[model samples]
Every structure is written in C-alpha cells, then in structure tokens.
Target: MNQYIDIVLRSVTIYFFILIALRIFGKKELSQLNTADVILILLISNSVQNAMVGANTSLISGIIAAFALFCINYIFKKVMLKSSFIKKLVQDKPEILIHNGITYYKTLARLGITSDELEEAIREHGLEHYNEVKLAMFEIDGNISIISGNEYLKQTHFKKKIIHKNLAGKK
Candidate 1:
C-alpha cells in the first residue's frame, strides 16, 4: 500500500514537472520535433519510467501509475478548456509575423524565428515573395500560416513542399 502511494505521488510530481517544463520551453518546441527532440523525448520517458514505477516492478503498480497519469491528463485538459486563465498559461497565443505586407521583425526575433525561416514558410505556402503575403502568423501549433492579398494566389490551408523552381523561375 505504501509503495503504491509513493508511485502515485512520484507519477503526479513527474507529470506536473514535465508540463511546466514544456510550458517554459515555449510553443515552438512543440511545433516540430527534430532529431534531437525525438531522442530527448525517448530518453525522458525512459528515465522517468523507473521513477514512476520504483522498486515494485509489479504489473498492478505499473497499471495504477499509468491510470493516474491518464486521469490527470484528462482532468487537466478539461480544466484548461473551461478556464481561460489556465488555458492561457498552458498554451501559447498565436503570433503575428506579418500584416499588410509589413513584417514584425521584433516579434519574429523575440520568438527566435529567423527571416529565412519566415521566407521558407512563405515559399512553402506557394507565395512568390513576402510582399505577396498580406498576413502571416505563427500559429500556436508551430505552423506558419500565410494569407495572400492577391485573390488569385490564395491557396488552401496546407503545408506544401516548397519547389525551388516553378514555371516563373526560382523565388
């Protein structure tokens, strides 16, 4: 019984710890998982597995810990949905990268996004140049969405691979 309580406590602590860590790391980290990010996630899971299970290696103990994690996650999500304050704390607001063909350099620099990356996102959206983009946003999900002022150049919301050479030539 005592060991089970310890497992639950450890699991809960680790869960909150990770949640806070992710929040502190910013939303960009969640947008795309690079090679290092994948390895880090794997290593974190492996390291915390033992901490959650402890010495009890029993199936029941493992199940209990897993159940606790799921329950906590579900409850957290529900609370976040209902409470704007909690939601704001747990998630990032969308960032405007460009508006009316003017780039927000300060916002981009603060978000650690380079001009090159922004240009790449613009190109990926099939826009020939930044001037063609009326609005560009770094969404909370880590995707850059572009809205073109040119009606003819507008495209559906999707992540398309940027082709270096089109009929018009390289952008």
Candidate 2:
C-alpha cells in the first residue's frame, strides 16, 4: 500500500478506537481534569503517535497523518450534526440527578457519582441543602447543573472549589 494511504488508514483507526474507548469509559472523564486525567491524556497521545505514523518518521508522513486526523474529525462532526442517531451515539444524553429536591439515587449510582459530590455541587450553586434544589442534571459535558427552588436565591454561575486535602487530611 502507498505510505500516504497507510498513514491515513492508521490515523482513522486510532481516532475511532480512542473515541469508542472514551465513550465506554464514561463522560465524567471528559468533564473534570485532575492531575491523573491530564497525565493520562498526554500519555495516550504519545502512545498513539507511533501507531498512527508507523515506521515512517519523515516530516511529510507526520504532516499527512495530522491532516488525515483533522479531516476525519471535521467530517465526523458534520455527520453528527446532520444525523440524530449519530449524534446520540457519539454524545451522552443529560441525566436528571435531582427533581423537586428528590435525589435520584439510581441515576447517581449508575453515573458513579457519590452523594458527597452531589452535595458539593449543590453547595457550589449556593444551596444549603438538597431540598433547596428544584432540578439538578448531570449534563452531557460532565457538569452538574443545579436549578434552585427559591427564585430569589437562584445563581447563574457556580465556582468549583479545589480541595487539596480531604476531611481525613489525606491528599
């Protein structure tokens, strides 16, 4: 096979594999970037670099591989926008975490979100208690969006706090 064609095929394969892997691992990984998450992303890119370019280390080969990746990514996004089924397959739907101040335990468990995390999200929205939340959703982007029941106390922006140490004094 032509080296350029080989590069294109390899790039496309790697792209699809990473996409499926991210989807299977859950969307939460995409939303929050802790130290480990950042390291993992860097390592993944390094590891896949050789797989995409193979034994060809020439500057042209590398450029071709990169161009192929960008092309496919653009095409994929366009297809996703035009096709609802493709969009649904590629993106996660928003999940209701709380409704009318009632926490959906099942949904929380399924999403691997603990109560403490939910409480923190609630507090970040300026709500003192879960009952003060009118609606809370785990958005497709991995953010927990909260709607307060008290119209007067509604908050439009939430600031997420970075905790260096836990309650047990462990990092």
Positional deviation of residue 31's Cα in model 1 after best superposition, in angstroms: 1.3
Assess candidate 2 and give its lDDT. Answer: 0.93
Candidate 1 lDDT over 1-171, as tens digits, reads 698889888899999999999988877777767899999999999999999989888999899899889988999999998999999988889999999889999999998898988988888778878888899999888888999998887565556576655544734
Which ten contiguous residues of candidate 1 have the minimum total lDDT? 162-171
Which segments of model 1 are wrong by more than 4 Å? 157-171
User: What does candidate 2's lDDT look like per residue over 1-171, in tens digits?
Assistant: 998999999999999999999999999999877899999999999999999999998999999999999999999999998999999998999999999989999999999998998998898888889898999999999999999989898576676667655554754
In angstroms, what RMSD does candidate 2 have relative to the true structure?
5.9
Q: TM-score for model 1?
A: 0.85
Candidate 2's TM-score reads 0.88
